[model samples]
Target: MSFLQRLTTGLTASKIGTDRFGNTYYESRKSWLGYGRKRRFVLYAGEPDPTTVPPEWHCWLHHVTDAPLSEQKRYPWQREHQRNLTGTAQAYRPPGHDYAGARRAPTAGDYEAWTPGG
Candidate 1:
């Protein structure tokens, strides 16, 4: 963190839960505003990419789930949550992708072409 951010947020050493792919979140026991009251704040150690968080962790972070993954059980049919990166270059390209390998058929002569002089 920069000197200005540290000074403005008044953050002290925090308890780290996990660190993955340069993303680390910490819980502070000190108030961010330094008003003598402590509030839990999750800070992204690196870039603030929402995809960095897994589904279970995302639910916990948003308070949607009361229990963490460690305390929870997964159903047999439940599939793991995967980040949606569609519309990007990394998206899935099926066999008939028009830009990749699909060929366009020649135009049919259903209607005569219009000619100004004819």
Candidate 2:
């Protein structure tokens, strides 16, 4: 949709908040087309990965929390947000992963197959 279309539908929308990942949230308390559900929209960052959303914003996005994270007090101990790394070069790969082509041979100690009542 063009900027004008989005702006028109959400003319009453107030900026909700933004996360560190560059995702922006907007919400309109008013109902749209008599649907009676609050209108909420998200302008996702670069590639639109769902995992990029933080817990606080995630709550608001799903209507779990009506108050935005920006309106609440967050502690410093909370860990930084991270997006899903699967399928990327940064993805985790075990030592025996097929793509890595490096498998470790199991030794006697590693072969401990359990037998019932043995």
Candidate 3:
């Protein structure tokens, strides 16, 4: 097997759960080198970005909820989790949108008559 695959193989975890977007989470059978002694870390099979983690899993990952989403009760007012991609090209740029293709407004006191040599 490949070196990367061999390294990951050490962390053996059964198929604990998966998200709608096909992000599978594994519960590490081994303990991480930390104070907790029995700490767990998640592995994203697809996009390995933290923003891709859903709210339900986010809470569990942070130890907010002891039970997984499959065994938990969701409230009606609960909103779907969305990754914040502000300041990026995906973000919306209202009407003016900086200075591109926009004309500057005329100022009230506009007088430009300066002779360098005179």
Candidate 4:
């Protein structure tokens, strides 16, 4: 965040809540005339990564709901939230992907090759 933004936010933003990721959520104390709604934002715990924000907080930040939904279910049936891992080693790699280095097994019913006028 820029110095100006930091200054403005410090002076005008109200702390709403903090996510499990340690990111803090905030809203402007007063709404802007043009927007008709208070500005909302997150101060990341470390590096500013949009992926770090969970779905509930994401919705709140975007004004999808007046308030963030309660904590997500923690039961065994519910899968935990994971940030995007596209560029990391822990990211998912399909069986035939170069990183996996394994070709997919052929299926029993293979399609015949197309030939022109044969």
Candidate 5:
């Protein structure tokens, strides 16, 4: 962080909570410019990846909730939070994707192509 950021955060930010990933959330101690709500922010434990934030904390960070939820209750069918892997090796690739095989089974001959005049 820059010197300016350190100073501002030190002067204005107050610790709100920490997430399971060790990220620390904060909100401003006072209203910003005395006109709007206090600012909210996070200090990432490691690399600053937004997707690392869990849903409950995300809601609090965005001011959707006044406080972080006490716990993240998961339903039996719910999957856990996962970091985005869009450009990484572990990202999802369908069977016909170029990185997979680039080939899909031929479609069943059930439909005919529509011509411009037909």
Candidate 6:
């Protein structure tokens, strides 16, 4: 965090929890920027990426959970979180895409071109 962001936020907050991703969560009842209600904040372990937050921790971060992520049980169906990669090389590219691979990788069987259905 920059010196200015630390000075402006999360200084007075109480440590609530830390996720497996190393992001530390906090809560502050103190008035920040003149807000009265409690506030939530995260001290990111690395660059601040919201998608890195898993489903369990996300709930607590948004006041949707009474308990932290550690207290929750993750079902087997839940997949790991993935950060957004819209512009990166790892981003999704369809076969017909112009920026990447061959345009429309041959989707065909026996095809017939009709001339007025004669």
| Candidate 1 lDDT over residue span 53-83, tens digit each | 7554666665565443552476999865455
Candidate 6: residue pairs that collide: none
Give the C-alpha lDDT of model 4.
0.89
What residue pairs are clashing in model 2? none
lDDT of 4 by residue, 7-118 (tens): 8878999889999889999999999899999999999988888988988899999999999888777898876667788999999998878888877767799678999998
lDDT of 6 by residue, 14-59 (tens): 7787888898888885756776567887889899888878777788
Q: What is the lDDT of candidate 6?
A: 0.77
Q: Order the candidates by lDDT, highest first — what do you get?
A: 4, 5, 6, 2, 3, 1
Model 2, 1-118: lDDT tens per residue? 4699577746678777778788888887687788667877777868878888777788888888877666346689866566678899888888788877779667676977889999
Worst-scoring 10-residue span by lDDT in model 3: 95-104
Question: Positional deviation of 40 in candidate 6, in angstroms?
Answer: 0.4
Better of 1 and 6 by TM-score: 6
TM-score of each: 0.43, 0.65, 0.55, 0.76, 0.78, 0.69
Count steric clashes of candidate 6. Answer: 0
- The list of candidate 5 runs beyond 4 A from truth reads 1-7, 75-78, 110-118
lDDT by residue (63-98, candidate 5, tens digit) is 899989877677999987788999999999988899
Better of 4 and 5 by TM-score: 5
| Per-structure clash totals for the candidates | 0, 0, 0, 0, 0, 0
- The positional error of residue 36 in candidate 2, measured at the CA in angstroms, is 4.3
Error of 3 at 72 (Å): 8.3
Compare the candidates by TM-score and give the number of the best one.
5
Task: After the best TM-score superposition of candidate 4, give how far the Cα of residue 92 lies from its true spot, in angstroms.
Answer: 0.8
